[model samples]
Target chain A: MTGPLGALRASAVLAIAALATLLQVSLAPHLAWRGVGPDLALLVVVAAGLAWGAHSGLLLGFGAGVVLDLVPPADHLVGRWALALMVVGYVAGRVRADLRPDRRPALGTIVATAAACSFVGTSVFALSGLVLGDATTGVGGLLGVILASVVWDVALAVLLVPVLLRALARLEPEHAR
Target chain B: MTVLDLRPRSPEPPERPGRPGPGGRDDARRPREGRRRPVRLPRPATGRGWGDDREPTPPRSLVVALVLAAASLMALDAAGALAPVRGAVAAVAGPAESAVSAVARPLTAAPDWVRSQGALRDDVARLRSENDALRGRLAAAPYASNRLREYDGLSRLTGRLGYAVVPAHVVGIGPAQSFADTVTLDAGSAAGLRPDLTVVNAQGLVGRVLSVTRSTATVLLVTDADSVVGGRVGTTMDVGTLRGRGEVGPHGLLDLELVDRDATPARDDAVVTWGSQGRGPYVAGVPIGRVTKVVSSVRETAQRAEIEPYVDFGALDLVGVVVPDGTRGDRGVIEADGTLVPGEAR
Candidate 1:
C-alpha cells in the first residue's frame, strides 16, 4: 500500500481513529452514569479490528491505549492498558473474521465487540487501581462502572458503526484484498 | 580370378580384427556427441519469484521488533522522554478535538436547549420556594439579630487585618478520583503566587499552592488527606493540629488534636492557623473552621475534635492566596494566651 491512493486511505483511517478517540474522551464523560463513562476508545479499537484485521488492530489498540493512559487523572501503571487493549483488539479481529460481511452482521459484531472490550478495559483498570491502593478505588464503584460502561459502549456502537464503516468504505476501493 | 585367390587367406591381429567399418563407427560416436552438447540453464530469479530460496524469518523478526518496541516504550515512559511527545500529541489533538466538537455541537446543543426549557419551569418553582424561605428568614431576622452583629464584627476584623485581598478564579477542577484533591487556578507565578502560599476564600481556608507554571498553578485543596495545618481553636485559646479526613461531603471534616488534654472545646469554637512568630506560610487569625464534635479520652494525652470547614470544597470558585512579603519563612504567630495572632507587619 504505497501508491498515492493507498496513502490517502491510510491517512483517512488515521484521522478517523484520532477523531474517534477524541470524541470518546470528551463526549463520553457527559453520558456517564454513576461516574462511569463509556469507553469510546475501546469501541474504536474494536471497530478498527473489524475493519483492518488483527495485526493493524493490535498495533493501533496499543498506541491508543498508551494515549489514554497518558491523559489527566491516570494513576495505573502505563503498560497495563496497552496489554489489555491489545487483547481486546486481537479478539475483536478474530470475531470479525467469522462474521458475514453484510451490514447487519457488521453492526452486530461492532455492538458485541464494544461491550466485550469495555468489560475487559474497565476490569483491568479497576484491578490496577486496587493493586495501587488508590483512595477512590472501591469494589462497588468498579462493578458499577463496568456495568455502566458496557451499556454505554454498546449504545455508541449501534450508532457509530454504520457511519464509520461507510466513511471507511468511501476511502478504500470497492474490492478489498 | 577365383582360381588365383583360392590359396591367399591369412590371420588378422586381435586388436584390429573386430574394428567396425566407417558407418558403424559413426553410430558409436552419436551417444558421445549428445553428451558434449551445451546444456541450457533456468531463467534468473526475480525478486518476486516463487522459487526463490532465500526465505525471510518472519516470526523471529516480528518477535524481535515487538520486544524492541516494548523496551523503547518502557524506557521512554520511565525517563519521561515521552513528555514532549505527549505534548505534541495534545497539540495535534486540539484541532481534531475541535472538529469533533463541531460535528457533535448540534447534538449537544439540542440537549442544552431542552435542559434550558426544563430549567425555566424549575426556576419559577425555585423562586417561589426561595420567596417563602426569605419571608421566613425575615420573620426570624429579629431573633437572629445578635448573630448577624457578630458576623459583621468578624468581617470588620478581617478588613482591619491589612491583608491585600486578591480574588482568583478557578479555571479547572481535578477529577474526583484524584487523591490530591487539587484545582488549577488561572493565576500563576506572574500573579505573585509562590509554592506553599496559603489560599483562602470568603468561607475559610481553602488550600496551599503546590506547583506554579507561567499562567497556571496547581493548588492542593485542604480537603486532601495528606494536608495538615497547625491551628488553634477560638478565644478559649487551645492549640491544635488540623488534618483533613478525605472527602466525606460538601465540606471536609478536619480532625483537630489539641496540645492540652485538659482544654475544653466548645461547639462552634473558631479554628485558626497557629501562625509561627509572623514567619509561617499561613497568616494567623484566618478563620479555618469551627469545632463540630469533641472526643475526650482520659487515657489519651490530647483531646480530638471534629471540625467542619467553613469553605465548601465542592462549590469553590474564587480564592485568595496570601502573598507574604520578602522571605518564605514562617508567618504564623502564637500569642501568650494560646490564641493565634493576626498578621504581624514586618
Candidate 2:
C-alpha cells in the first residue's frame, strides 16, 4: 500500500475528508437537531479506520481533524479534534483487525462500531476541552451533546459506512484480485 | 464482487500444506506480480485477531505521538501563537466553506419551505404578510409629516457622525465543529473589517468580528457563554454586565448582573449596550434586548436579570458592520439641539 496506487488512495481519502469538513461546517449546522448536528468528519474518519488498517486510520484522522479545526467559524482548540480523531481511528482499525478479522463487517456491526467510536471521540474531545479550558458546555450540557452526537452518528452510519467501505475497497482491487 | 463479501458466507475450504487450494484467496498467498502485497493481507498467525491487512501495534505508537503533538498545539494556540497559522488555514478553507454555504443555503431553508408547503397555510401566510405590509404602509402615512420634519436632523446626524456602514450577510452558523456560538460573514478584510468591529442587524446588537480572512470573517455572537458586554437598563440607568448563555430562542437568555447594590431591575425593562471605550466591539445606545426575568442575589448585593435578545440569531440575514470613515478630518459628535461635541472618542 505504499506505491502510486497507495498515493492515489491516500489523496482520495484526503478529498473525502475535505468534503466532510466542508459539509460539517456549512450544511450540518442547518441540519442540527436540537442544537446538535451529526459529526460527518468524525464518522468519515471512523470509516477510514474500518476500511483501512490502523496506520491509515491514524494518518487520516489527524489530517481531517485539522481541516475541521480550521474551518470557518471554528473556535475550539486547534488540536482537540486531531487528538480525539486520532484515538478514534486507532481504536476503530483495531476493532476490525481483532474480534472479526477476516470476514467483512455486517451493517449491524458497522453501526455499532460507529456509535461506539462516536461516543469515545466526543467524550475525549469534551474532556480535553475542559482540561484545556475555554469550554462553554458544562458537565450536564456536555453529556447531552455526547448523547446527541452518538445518535446522529449512528443514524448516518447506516448509510455512510457501507458506501465508504465499498469505495475504499475499490482502491485495492489489484491486490485483492 | 468477490472483494466485498458483505453477505454472510460459510468458512473457506481448508488448505493443504505445500500447495494452496484452487481459489487461494484467503490463504497467505502473495500477489502474482510479487511486487505488491495482497490487499486482504497475508493472514496473521493462528488465533490472530480479525481481518486487517497489517499488524495493529505500530498504530498504537503513532496515536501516542500524534496525541502529544496535539497537546503541544493546544498549548501554543492557547498562548496566542497560532493566530497566523490559523489564519493561513482559514485563508485556504474560508472560500470553500463560503461557497458551500452559499450553495446549500436553499437546503437550509428547505425545512421551513417543506413545513409551509401545505396549500392552505401557504396561502394564509402569504396573505398575512401582504396584509402586514399594507397595514405598515397605512400606519406610516400619519407619520409622514413627522418623518419629514426629522429628515433635517437625520441628515445633520449622518454628516456629524460620518461613520458609514458596510453591508454583509451571514454565510454560515456553526454546529459540532465549534462549541461556542459563531457565524461566518460574507465580507472580511477586503471589506475593511477588522477584529473588534460591531456587527448589528436592524433589530439590535448581534456580535463582534472575532477573526477576518481575505474574503470572510467570523463573528462571535452575543449568545455565546464566554461573551460579556457592558449593558445598562433604560429606565434605571444602572450599568451592569450582560452575558450570553450559549443558546437561542426563549430558553436561551442573556444574564444581566447589575453593578449597583440597590439597583432594582424589573421585568420587561429594556437593555442597551454601554459603548466600548473606542466605539468598537459595541457602540453606545444600540438596543440589545428586553429583560425577561429578574432574580436578585440573596447573598451578594448585585442584582441579576435574564434578557431575551431582540435579534433572532437562528434567522439572521442582512447585517451592517460599522467602520469608521476617516476622511474630512475632525467630524464632531452629534448631540441633541444641534450641538457638536467634537469627536473625541478614542
Candidate 3:
C-alpha cells in the first residue's frame, strides 16, 4: 500500500479509531447500564483488526486503549486496556481472511467475540487495579462490569460491526484490492 | 492416502527464484544442521508453527516491544510517576469533552423535553390546586399561630429568648442518596450567619450552621447521625440528650436518651431544646419534637424514647438562623467576632 490512496486509508483508519475512542469516553455515561457501557473503543479495535491484519490491529488497539486510559473518569492504571485490547485485536485478526465473502463467521461468533473482549478487558482492569494497591475495587464490582458491559457490547457489535467492515472495505488500498 | 494428503488443498503457485514459497516450508521445518537462523524473522525456528500465508503474523519483536512498553507505562502510572502526563492529557481532553457535550446536549434533552412538557402541565394543575389549599391555610395561619402562641406561652418565651433571627432560603440540597446529611443556605456571614448558630423554621428546630462563607452557609441537619441536642420533655421537664436517628422519612426520628429512669413521660409529650449556656448551637426552649415511644428496662440506667421531629427536614424551603439581637436590630452593634453588643449596628 503506497501513495495518496494509502495515505487516505491510513487517515481514515486513524480518524475512525480516534473518534470511536472519544465517543466511548464522552457518551458512555449517558448510555450507562448499571455503571457500565459498551466499550465502543474495543469494538473499533476489533473491527480494525478483523478488516486488516495483525500489524494494523495491534497498532489501532494500542492507540485507542491508551486514549481511553488517559480520558477523564478513567481512574485505573494506564496500559491495562492497551495490553488486553492489543491481544483481542491480534486474536480477532487471526480469524481466516481466506474465506469467501459469503463464508464469513456467523453472527454468533461475532457476539461471542464481543462478550470475550468485554470479559478480558474487565479482568485486566481489575487485576491491574489490585496490583496497584486499590484494595476496595473488589471482584464483585468487576463481575458486574463484565455482566453489564458484555450484554451491551454484544448488542452494539450486532449493529456496528457490519457497517464498520463496509467502511473499511471502502477504504482498502489499491494494492490490497 | 494420509489424512494430511486427503485434506482438500488450494492450488499453489510456483515460488519466485530468490523468494521462498508462501508456505515457507523450510521456515516451518527446523533450520538445516549447520545453517544460521534468518535475520528476517525475530524468533528461532521453534516459533509457533505456521499461520496461513494469506493472513500475516504480526512481527513478534514489535509485539513484544509494544507490550513491554505498555507494561512499563502501567507500572509507572501505578507508582504515580505519570501524574503530570495524565494531567496534560486531561487538560487537552476536557475541552474536547465539552465540545462533545455541546453537540450531544440537544439530543439528550429532546426526549426529556418532550416528556417534561406533559409533566409540566400536570405540575401546573397540581400546583394550582395546592395554591388554593395553601390560600385557605394562609387565611387560617395567623389565627392558629396566635392561638398557639397564647396557648403555649410561645411569644412570652421567645421575647425572653433575646436571639436575633435571620431568614434564609434553602437554595440547594445535597444528594439524598449520599450519607452526609447537609443542605446549602443562601444566607452566609454577610447575613450574620456563623458556624454553631441554630437554624429553625415555624414548625421547629432544623439544625445548626456547620460552616459559613461570604454568600453561602452549609447547614448540618438535625437528622444527621452525628447530631445531638439537649431536650426537655414538656410539663414533666425530663431533660435528655436528643440524638438524631438518621431515619429515612420526611420527618426523621430522634432518639431521646439519658432520661431519668423514674421520669415516665407519656407518648406525645412535647420536647424542646434545653438551651446552651452562651446561646450557642441550640437556644433554650425551641420545640424539637413529640415523644413517639418510650423504651424502658429495669436493667437500663436511663430510659430512651423515639421523638418525631415537627419540622420536615427533607422538605425544607425557608428557614431562619439564630443570631445575636445586636445583628438583628439597628440599635445594637455587632462585634468583630460577630457577637452582638449593646451599641448600635451599622
* lDDT tens per residue, model 2, B1-346: 3334421222433234457645565453543443243244334334323234645544345667788888888888888888898898889888998999899989987886777678668799999999999999999885665444443433343344344555567888877346688889887777677898877766677888899997688998898988888999999899999999886442357999998978878889999888875886787777789998888757977888999988778767666666665411122322333333443332
Model 2, docking class = acceptable
C-alpha RMSD values across all candidates = 31.2, 31.9, 24.1
Ten-residue segment with the worst summed lDDT in candidate 1 chain A? A1-10
lDDT of 3 at A9: 61
User: Model 3, B97: alpha-carbon shift in Å?
Assistant: 1.3
Of candidate 2 chain B, the 10-residue stretch with the lowest lDDT total is: B327-336
Could you tell me the lDDT of residue B240 within candidate 3?
91
Q: What lDDT does model 2 reach?
A: 0.75
Q: After aligning candidate 1 to the native by TM-score, how far in Å is the CA of B29 from where it should be?
A: 44
List DockQ for all candidates.
Answer: 0.04, 0.24, 0.16
Ranking by lDDT: 2, 3, 1
Q: Model 2 TM-score?
A: 0.48
Query: What residue pairs are clashing in model 2?
Result: A101-B50, A101-B51, A102-B51
The reply for model 1, stretches above 4 Å from the true place, is A1-10, A70-80, A100-106, A128-136, A173-177, B1-75, B95-106, B109-119, B129-346
Q: Which candidate would rank higher by lDDT, 1 or 2?
A: 2
Across residues A1-177, which tens digit of lDDT does each residue of candidate 2 receive?
Answer: 542226777788889988988888889988898989999988888888887767778777887887777776789888899988887887787777665555567888889889999999999899998998868979999999999999999999899988887777667643445
Leading candidate by DockQ = 2
- Computed on C-alpha atoms, the DockQ of candidate 3 is 0.16
Model 1: residue B27 alpha-carbon error in angstroms: 43
Q: Model 1, retained fraction of real contacts?
A: 0.07
